[model samples]
Target: MSRSPTFVRALGYLALALFLGMAVVLRFVIGPDVSFTPQAEIGRYSDADLVALGAELRETGQAGLYKFILLGVDFVFITVFGLWVMLVHAIRGLGPVRWVGVALACAFMALDYGEDLMLAIRMGLATKGNLDPAVLTNPVSLVHYVTLAKFAVFALCMLSVYFVSRRRA
Candidate 1:
């Protein structure tokens, strides 16, 4: 049976609320209390040094990759948001499938949160009343690759759920 457009839109709103709600709680509420904000938390690396690093990246091979990634993420976020709409409509319509979109969203955001946490940890900021001494090590740079992969996996899971749910719809 098909659902009213209003009901479907309401479901979409609920899904979106769940998505943005976690993001907000993480960013504004939990993040500050447990993050590696260098200027405010670590403060060992001077701002000037960070500025130089940014300049260096802009002039090096890494800049293209970074820019490509940032652009890719912009597209990804849009896709995920669109999926929320699809899932919401499906749920309101009372189709055979349930929990697919929510499941994917949960998994996606889980890794997203995890990667963010790992990056925070890598920054070596003092959390839990302990400061990271090896914050500036070159070895830590490699870890970013793993974090990026986790992020990609999160996106893949989200996309997969969206497509699966969409196909079912």
Candidate 2:
């Protein structure tokens, strides 16, 4: 399960590139007005808040772009970042602790994907004018909890990377 330093470096560069590209798009293209979407929100947001954001995006004619960023750019970014984290752990030789990093990477990526999927589904329903409260409840709740879980796991992943790097040094 060991990875070469070269491979790890390449993955890190790719992850960085993807992250920067996504950031630029979010900052410039999506802009600040529609920047406060659920995916970017760190904590639990109400169903009304989600609906309001969706409506705002729709009204501003940025709903499609927002969805594209979430489902498209963010998806690629999450996969690349997760793989980079796993590869870094492997390259650093964390011994038994390496497995924990790998598991954290997997959990982080899963939670992120789950959150994105829920938001996308909610957006889709909003776009179609079919955002029935009953249908929205489960997805909204999933997005809320999954977003929190994603952040916690991401923090753990970063801490694991730090520990591995420190051990290597």
Candidate 3:
């Protein structure tokens, strides 16, 4: 049941291409205009900040684009990036190290997805003018924490892969 090296390599390349493509699209094509996009803002943001971002998106008619980037492009990007990380670890064949990298990759993907979903929900509420402070607080906090977790896990995963590959070499 072992996969061929060629097959695994091909999949890794494909995943990388898809991930990069989506990244370009997000960065230059349909991404939000604000510099402090929720996804890029690793630091903690106030509920008020989140609310204002939503409002700005709505006012600028970028709300739909923001939601699309989160639920659509980013969804695909996260999946492909996670798969790419796992495949890289698999190719490295570092036993426990590989497994740890894979686990971290999965965790990163999950946190990213959760962060995007929470942001989308916040945006939806903002779009609907349901800006009750109570309604916004939980999602805003969730997005912030999840985003931080996602970046941390991603960094760990990449470091594990790098160290494993270097050690093998």
- Give lDDT per model, in order: 0.43, 0.75, 0.70
lDDT tens digits, residues 1-169, model 3? 2433675566557666766765665567545565467677767776567767777777777777777767877787687778767876777756687788788888988898888767766656424645577855653466777788888897897787667556643
Candidate 2 pairs with clashing backbones? none
Q: 2-30 in candidate 1: lDDT tens per residue?
A: 43356555655665665565456445643
In angstroms, the error of model 2 at 132 is 4.4
Model 2: lDDT equals 0.75
Instruction: Evaluate model 3: give its TM-score.
Output: 0.75
Per-candidate TM-scores read: 0.36, 0.81, 0.75
Output candidate 3 Cα RMSD: 3.9
| Stretches > 4 Å off in candidate 2 | 1-4, 125-132, 135-140
TM-score of 1: 0.36
Q: Cα lDDT of model 1 overall?
A: 0.43
| TM-score, structure 2 vs. true | 0.81
